[model samples]
Target: MSKLVEEFNDYRTRMNEVILSKNNLVMKRLWNLDTNTYEEGALDKKTKEMLGLVASMVLRCDDCIKYHLGKSYELGVTTEQMYEIFAVANIVGGTIVIPHTRRAAEYWEELQTNAQ
Candidate 1:
């Protein structure tokens, strides 16, 4: 598994053990209400993912960026397209995405045989 997925799963396991509800409560509320405003809005999936990368960059979420970048590639996002995405990030969010870019590279290096 990608480390991002593993980490997220590990976090989910720990959170399940804690019996404390958090982090996703608000999103859950939205989910349960069937109000996928974000999903239903103007953005398409690939575009949304690109924006997700931008948000991850702004939030300095290295794992998130790594995860999304991999998924982005799987979705046929080209390197040049990613470069364009990076240009957008640089213009709007600046250098915060650098660590995420590095994390994405490392995660790619660590990718196994896709057995997971």
Candidate 2:
């Protein structure tokens, strides 16, 4: 895997372990909710992930963007669809989201490279 992708996954995993080890009920429940929310349902996992990517971009959360981007890629979202998602996010989020879009593109590239 690319260093960028590997590092992100490693750090996220380590932190999640630490956080979950605390045994905080609310945090655990919230995490569980997040997990369950992305399951195959009325909307389907792929569509939900696309929406997640859009919302993450608009919110300017790089981590969330990366997470959704990874999921979207795994779910077989095409490059064309990704660009469309970016366009929608840029439109809804305004110019402020441009920087995030750049980062997201970088992360997506890393994901592609890792896959190869």
**TM-score for each candidate, following the candidate numbering:** 0.57, 0.98
Q: What would the TM-score be for candidate 2 when compared with the true structure?
A: 0.98
lDDT of 1 by residue, 1-116 (tens): 75655776588568655643565776667645532433546776677778877777777777567756766766767667877777777677777667666665556444432433
lDDT of 2 at 6: 86
lDDT of 2 by residue, 12-44 (tens): 999999999999999999999999999999999
- Candidate 1's TM-score: 0.57
Instruction: Indicate the worst ten consecutive residues by lDDT in candidate 2.
Output: 107-116
**What lDDT does the true structure give each of the candidates?**
0.65, 0.95
